[model samples]
Target chain A: MKPIIEISGISKRFRISHELQPYLNIRDRVSQIFSGKKATSTEEFWALKDITFSVEAGESIGIIGKNGAGKSTLLKILSKITPPSSGKIISRGRIASLLEVGTGFHPELTGRENIFLNGSILGMRKNEIQGKFDEIVDFSGVEKFLDTPLKHYSSGMQLRLAFAVAAFLEPEILIIDEVLAVGDAEFQKKCMGKMDEVSKSGRTILFVSHNMGAVSNLCSKAVLLRDGKIAMIDNSSKVVEQYLHDSVQMSGKRRKTISALDKSFTLQLPYWVNNAGEEIPSYSFGSDYKLRFDFEFHRELTFLNIGIAVMNKDGSRIFTSHSVDDKSFQSFSTYNGKMTFDAHLNIPDLAPGYYQVLFGVADEHTHDYVNASSEVEVILDIAETHKIKDGANGILWHTGQWKKVG
Target chain B: MEYEIKPAGRFSLNLSELWEYRELIFFFTWRDIKVKYKQTFFGAAWAVIQPLLLMVVFTVFFARNFTIESGNIPYPVFVFSGLLLWNVFANGLSNAGNSMVANANIIKKIYFPRLIIPISSILSAMVDFLISIIVYFCVLFFYGLQSTIPSILLMLPLSLLITLCTTLGAGSFLAALNVKYRDFRYVIPFLIQVLMFMTPIIYPVSTPDMEWVRTLLLLNPMTGAIDLIRSAVMQVPVNQTAVAMASVSSLLWLIIGISYFRRTEYYFADLA
Candidate 1:
């Protein structure tokens, strides 16, 4: 069977005016020819260069790219919003896209009419649309004001209605481009639920999002678009790992600095089971995250204290852990030896992102700092979008739930 | 097997595809109408007001002492008939010309036929035209104008068809050009003003006995349309020859305009 969406050797060239290019007035236009001056020169910019891909039926594909990566341009071509400058596209079925929510709702038309209007534009038959009308309204959660004109609806309300209509239509192929990132977390979950159902029903989906967590969760396979070309295409786990590595490098990675070893104190990560052993990649959230430290001592006595602070991407500490703070086990009294300190942590409550962590070893009296480290990228892949079927829990991992018996 | 790219870009006038999107056309047309009249104190009566004011101005200055040799019809009736056709023509033309540019966001982001933009703009003007027709009916009754029953009925659709043809031709033509040239906007309204008189809107084509002059005026398609409308309202016999002339000419212009529009429309998302 032929793939539902086939893109072959496609490319697009756009002629863009250079801002700094000098302009010639109409009177000067003729003078340039006689004066031997170049007039109206252009620069050809390839927005998408020689790209090809295909999606089989019932497949969910994620497209990830940085800015100017041609992710959106590729989707626009697939949806037939714009034609490619070269090559051909053979698509087997109707395509419904929600590049932006509530795209063409007339402010004057009531929510009810706009629904039908949007439905028809997405290529649903009138009678066919009428049957799903109530479901669309209910999913949108804008039923009470269905009779009111759409212009009066808030942006969120409009987005709700728009997304509900698009997702509910069940087109043979669906194209989504970063629109879901606008809605609140709850609505994103709701959309994720619907997308899950749609894919299960054997419709193809091409989703483009910068949010790596959403991509890895919702997509079975993924493509990393870089500089108008397919940089990589692999399973969600592999692609996400590569994407996060790229994200880590882009967010201004660690700068070269003098190690504070000559000072009274220093903090360094303890390497335990790194396969290559140079520096283990930072652990992700929800995984059994382990932070190991090589605790060193030059001259130490008794009652020594040390604490580990895990700060979010912005350096706000979610919570801190202390070795001395938790007692009844043991205390530190050492001389000069490198000892491994392993703090195994199951981090569940924190959101998925890059964060900073600092480990400091300090004492009660001398007021001397022993060690410190900063800017480690801990990428946490949130629970996958369709994890409920796999018996996965909610957004935040649960420690326990209470039950009452009367 | 891959074929070489052809520059003779195939015009996709897929009506069935448009039929699938019929609801969007209606919704957008509804959008234009609602936004047009909403919050205005005059309500939908503004439709009647605009043409009535133009009618009064034409009646006062142009009709007061003018005798331009209409086809045996009174001056006010002649001007009013012309105004009726011109109102629809002008309103539809302006609205459709700017519809594509005005809905730039939708045009760029969504996947709908950009052709629907101008077509819906023309459709929205029907509301105003229908309302003003009632006013025209009263004006005809008060003056005791002999309403040509057969001709009026037959020519109403004919006049509308001509108006639609002119609008689609001019509107689509301008809409594509407007994307490329911002300067066309300033030139358009001024051009419309000159076209109003050039089309014999306020006067008949020419004296009945002036053979060359009448023939010259017949070259204008709107001349045929306006003359047909006047002949209908004033209970005159049909001019099949002039209409045959106008229909052929107007249809040619329509084809030329749409073909030019199709050639340029592919670049709109980039240029606009």
Candidate 2:
């Protein structure tokens, strides 16, 4: 089978101008020419370099990397929204890209009108849009507001309408950026399902996203980019694992410095410690640990809640614990003085990786009393005494009884 | 259809590629026309009202004040015809000049013929031009006059076509420039104002005792078009020299405008 798209040694260079004014007026240009002062300076920034890749006719490939890794540049080149500074790309079929939702949606136009306008802008023919008009409206669930102007629709509704138009596009190749980062959870799930359906239909897809789970689930092949170069390309699961592992080392042990002042109080940065009250680099999953921070109160504060939240690298919260959760510390209060606060914790069965511990103080009633806060990242590793599977299929784990009922 | 994406050549104007995206130009034009009239009190009436009111003003200020030679045509009828074509040129120029910047969002997100943006602006102006044409005919009828020239109807569209060509050329040139140097945004309206006077819109090119000024005004592409419209509709003897000059100049401007636009369009995404 032949590849449907071929990219060879494509590179893009941008000249970063360091002029004080973003744009020049005729007077300034004329005066500068007479004065012979070529005051502007520019530096060359290569956004992509020698990015060679090819996709088979039915393959779904995920391009994953940190921000500024040239994923967007490559997509822009493929979509022909912008030209590459050098090299070339050859494709055998019509390619459409959804770099952003609602690319040409007019605010004053009705939802029904925007559907047609955005569809045409995305390279859909008039009859093609007409044929799918019903499906697109049904999918967006904006039937009642079809004639109402788009400005009145909630932002989420607008996004759904935009995505619905693109979803019905019958292009031979589809490239999508991180359009899934918005909208509600249910809508995101719907979008994911739609993408899954498109991938199964044997068209080519190139997806760029920070959602590792989505990438691993939907894509069979994954490419990792770093500093405008292809860092790795392999099976989706393997590449996802490597990216997760590398990200841990890349952001190693970031610490928040003590803030100078606040109206209510000031708190030192939080840190992880074990039973011995000594700081440790990491704590094994399921082990008892404590995160402690010292605070100096400026005035009497009653009914305060000190809480800590554990979040994954993607910033999704695993769980949260508040000091008030303990029966003994249900009504903790602080007076004008220095005091140390500690929250004891035990991690549940979670995937072994780095997690961020965000600790803050808040007034239980006002919620606005989160007058001071800080966060610290800590590593959670497998327990040395326990044996576990080499590779985990999901983010969580729980012990289940193994006696066979049969 | 297969596509090979590479660096654009210096002067590559791919008409076939433009042909493929022709529908987009229509869609863009529709959107512009819709948006321009939406939420307005007068809607398409504004199109007719604009040239109609301009004709009233010019007829009062210029026709009554000065004895302008307009052949057998009533001064008001002659001025309305000129205003009809001049509005198309002026509106088309300003709209196309700012079109790339106005549609910068679409240009950055999708790929189509960049020329479609300016072309659509010109098309939307044509919509208004058509409305104004209807008003012009009504005015001519009210004046109890009719074109004695048997081929006046045919020549009318021909002259309008020349006007369209000239506007497209000049508009695209300004549009491309506006994308890189947004200061052209300010220059466009001012340029249009100066150009209206330079063209023979309000005053006839055959005004007496101004031979040098008449020659300079005829050099303007629009002067030939407006003069042609007068001669064809008012049954004045056609100035063959002006008609020939306007056609060649319009073509030259079209070539120059589109080629300059083609050379600089690749950077529009970056600069706009």
Candidate 3:
């Protein structure tokens, strides 16, 4: 079977001039013309370079990258929103891009009128939109307000209506770029289910999103981009794993520079260690691990409090542990001059994959912490050691006690 | 279904792509018309009232003050016919000139034939043109001016076509220029004001007995269009040279405008 989309040697160069304004006004242009002064210097920056990739029919490919990694540039080129500076893209089927929802929705027009307008703007035929008008209204769940002007609708309702129009676009290939970032969680889930259904029905999908879990779950293969080039092209799960591992290493380097700059007191980078004091790279899932944080106080201190928070890859905190929560550890407030303290944190039942450990220090009385406040991120990798099938659903892998009641 | 996208030529007029997006053009035009009169108190009546009010002011100021001969037709009826077509050209030109900036949100997000924006702006103005035409006929009837049905049918369409072409050409050119320079935003309204006087909408083109003034007024592409509509309704003989000049100038403007627009439309999403 032939590939549905063929992209070869694609690159986009943006000429960025460091001017006072992004756009020139008539006065500046007129002055330049009369004075005969050449325009300011401009630097050519490549947003994407030599990006060659192809997708087979019925394949769902996820393009994963960090911010400014050229992911959006590649998608825009494919969608024909912007032309590449060099190279060509041969696409075999009609491509509809949903880079943003409600591309041409008019605020003064009614919901019914906007549906047709927005549908046509998305490249859908009038008859096709008419056929799916009921379905779209049903999907958006805004039937009661169909005749109401769009300006009266809440922003969320407009978003749903916009999303509904895009969802029904039956193009052979769909290029979506982070459009799911907004909307409520329930609506997001609905969009995901709809996209999954579309992919399963033998259509090509190119998805670009920051949600690694969604990318891994929805796509069979993934392309990891770094610095405007393809870093890896492999199975979705493996590429996500590689991306997480490399990201942790980068954050680790950043962690060092942060701690090294502090002169008043030294706080060593947090790491996982076994009971024997040997540092370990990863901990087993559903097992206990000791988190050691060593800090040296240069001067006398009082009411010093410490806290730890474990966050998942998405930067959402799973749980937090504060030294003030424990009655025994609360008294170690005063620190003599040049005294070193080792705070051992024993956290258990974390699921597999990488997490960021946030360590914070505060003062209860003076409220004068480390230059106001400090939170250091340390990468914690956990390996899968769960005996249960399919591992776990959340960050925690706790095995609760189950007993029969008489 | 299969297509290859590459760097487009600077002067490629991709009409097939424009044809493919015809529905979007209709939707855009419909949206404009709906939004234009959405919350207004008089609604479509404003289309009639605008030119009627302008005619009333011109009759009071120009018709009574100057002894300008408008053939056998009443001066109010004569000026109303010119205002009908003139309003279409002026309003269409203004709307088209700003269409690109007005729809910057859509341009930045999706891909479609960018010409649709300017073209739809012109089309929306035609709706008002139709409304104003009906009101002009009522004024013509009030003045007891009778125009042959065949002449009205033939001349009205020809005159409208000329006005449409002139507006499209100039409107699109201004739209593209507005996106790049933004100076045209202020320049367009001023240009429209200058063009209204230059087109002989209030006074007869013949009133300026100087050959140079008459020639200069005829040079404006809109002069022929407004003259054609006025003569067609008033049963006055049309000037062959003026109509010929209008056609050639309108065609030139159309080519220059569309070519410039096509060359620069690719950068609109970035610069708009």
Which predicted model would earn the best DockQ? 2
Rank by TM-score, descending?
Answer: 2, 3, 1
Give residue B152's error in model 1 in angstroms.
0.8
**lDDT of each residue in A47-87, candidate 3, tens digit only:** 99999989999999999876678998898888877888899
Task: Encode model 1's per-residue lDDT on A1-406: one tens digit a residue.
Answer: 8888778888887787664347657778777778877765679988888888888888999998766789888887776667788877778777778777767777878899888777776767778779999999999999999999887999889989999888777778889888766676589889888887888898888999765556767789999877888888898657766766665455324322222344532334433223333344544444454566655554454655656665543224567777776765377566345556666544656544444444556666633363233123333233232222343343343446668986
Interface DockQ of candidate 3: 0.66
Off by over 4 Å in 3: A20-39, A252-347, A355-406, B148-150
- Chain B of candidate 1 versus the native chain B: what TM-score? 0.90
Q: Write the per-residue lDDT of candidate 1 for residues B1-272, one digit (tens) a residue.
A: 22222122588676785776777788678878878987789989898888778878877887677756655666666777888878777888788777778888777777777778888998998888888887877777777764564567678887678768877888888888888887777767887887887778777765546787677667667778887878787676767777877777778767877777877877777677
- The per-model lDDT (C-alpha) reads 0.71, 0.82, 0.82
Second chain alone, TM-score for each candidate: 0.90, 0.95, 0.96
Q: Which digits, one per residue and each the tens of the lDDT, describe model 2 over residues A1-406?
A: 5689999999999999788677899999999999997758889999999999899898999998866889998998899878898889999988999999999999989999999999999999999999999999999999999999999999889999999998998888999998886676699899999999999999999999877667878899999998888999998878876776665455435544454233676666666678888766556777787777777777777667778777664546689888777887646544567877667776667766655555556665635344222222333333344667765545675555679799
* Candidate 2 overall lDDT versus native: 0.82
Report per-candidate DockQ: 0.19, 0.75, 0.66
Docking quality tier of candidate 2?
medium
Candidate 1, residue A349: Cα displacement in angstroms equals 14
